[model samples]
Target: MAAPLFLLAPPRSYTSLVNAMLGQHPQCFGLPELCLFNVDTLVDLWRGSAAEISENGPMARHGLLRAVAEIYCGEQSTATVNMALRWASVREHWTTGQVFQEIVDKIHPLVAVEKSPSYTISVKRMRAMLDTFPDARFLHLVRHPVAQAKSLLAINDGAFTIKVNAFEIGEDYALMEPQIAWHDINLNILDFLDKVPPAQQMRMRGEDIMAQPEQRLAEIARWAGLRDDAEAVDQMMHPERSPFACFGPINALFGNDPNFLAGPTFRPHTPKIPPLSKPVPWRDDGKGLHPEVVQLANEFGYV
Candidate 1:
């Protein structure tokens, strides 16, 4: 079995695009955000986790359902998705690792590439992936804390911060802190990666990938033991070409970010990297990133 390539990053770090792009490689099968490792069994996903904040409802199941439909049934349609539901029902009792192995086996030889940012919230979840796929390759995708925090705040008022328990509790109130989320999530990834061999893991900036997709993507392809030739490089350029790049059927409309689903096309351009000292745009208080956030950002090679 070909060990899967998992992108480890917090949300809004270009994981969806990168995963799809890599999946488009001739030797890869880019998967939607399966989020299977978030739980121990398939039934746990439906029944929900202990933490209400972690419970994802039906939308979370969409990715696995869509993937099952496409991989096993040869298409993702209403009928196929319903068939996926039946498929899951039969395997609800199986360990999530077992189910993931089945999918990896089904797409053998074509490396499975996936990213579910939620997996970074807990070390256990990431360790589950490593335990299941002992030889899994991990890509630690980093982003500027300022840019990532701003993006998180823009979405549902930084809802993910709450999910990660990233907050500052003042005497009067508790405020969401995106930078904390960014720092902690990356730290979690680092801790988990400590057990992985150096050769099995790589760290790359999301901004770098955006700035030089062709060169950087070819580098990544070569690193993953995939084809770095023109044909494969050209294929990797068009993330939209991936089956999971767009919205799935009505029953399973999203296996990736909704924003990405709406416009799955890849347009290469340099992303703006805001100065660390400047006041974050998402904050009303003229405050820059937290000291810890700045420290981590510097460690990541950001100015």
Candidate 2:
């Protein structure tokens, strides 16, 4: 079996679109965010999160549901989702790694490409993935901290920050800080990548992919040991062709970002990169980025 390719990044860093783009490769099967490693066993996904942060809600299972529905039954419908539920029930006692392997095996020959932003929330879950697939390749997807934090605040009223507990606790006012989440999550990815052999991993900037997809995609294809010829590159150019690129049935509605689902098409254009020292637009107090954020963003090649 070919080792699966996993994209690692914080949420809203163009992961959904990129995952689809990569999946469209003729030799690859782009998967929705399975989020299987968030728990130890298949059953834990249904039990929901007991931690301060609730990780295993209905939305968390949506990706797996859509995947099972489409893979097993060849379609996603309320009926298929029910079948998927029964499918999961029988393996409730199995470890998440085992369940993922089943899905990977089911889709053998083609590489499985997946990215769940939640996986970066904990090193243990990532370690579990490595333990399960020793040959798995990791692509540490990155975006400018400034751009990423702003995108986070734009969605769900910045609720993602709460998931990472990214906040500034002052003597008086406790403030939600999205940059903290950005810095720390990337930090977590870096620390985890330290354990992985350098050859099994690569880093790419999301903005670069957006700016020049054909070039970047071809570069990635070469790195993954896939076909980098014109035919393969052309296939990757249309991420919309991937089955999981669109919204699933009503029952298994989403396994990807809704924005991407609404418009899964890829448009190539250069992204704006803001100066790291300026005060973030989301803040009113005129405080600039934390020193650590600047350091990290610089490390990511964001000036």
* lDDT, model 2: 0.91
On residues 127-236, what C-alpha lDDT tens digit does candidate 1 reach at each position?
99999999999999999998888888887777778877898888998778888999999999999999999999999999999999999999998898889999998999
**Model 2 residue 227 lDDT?**
95
TM-score per candidate = 0.97, 0.97
- Poorest lDDT segment (10 consecutive residues) of candidate 1: 48-57
- Residue pairs in clash, model 1: none
Model 2: how far is 159 from its true place, Å? 1.1
Deviation in angstroms for 23 in model 2?
A: 0.3
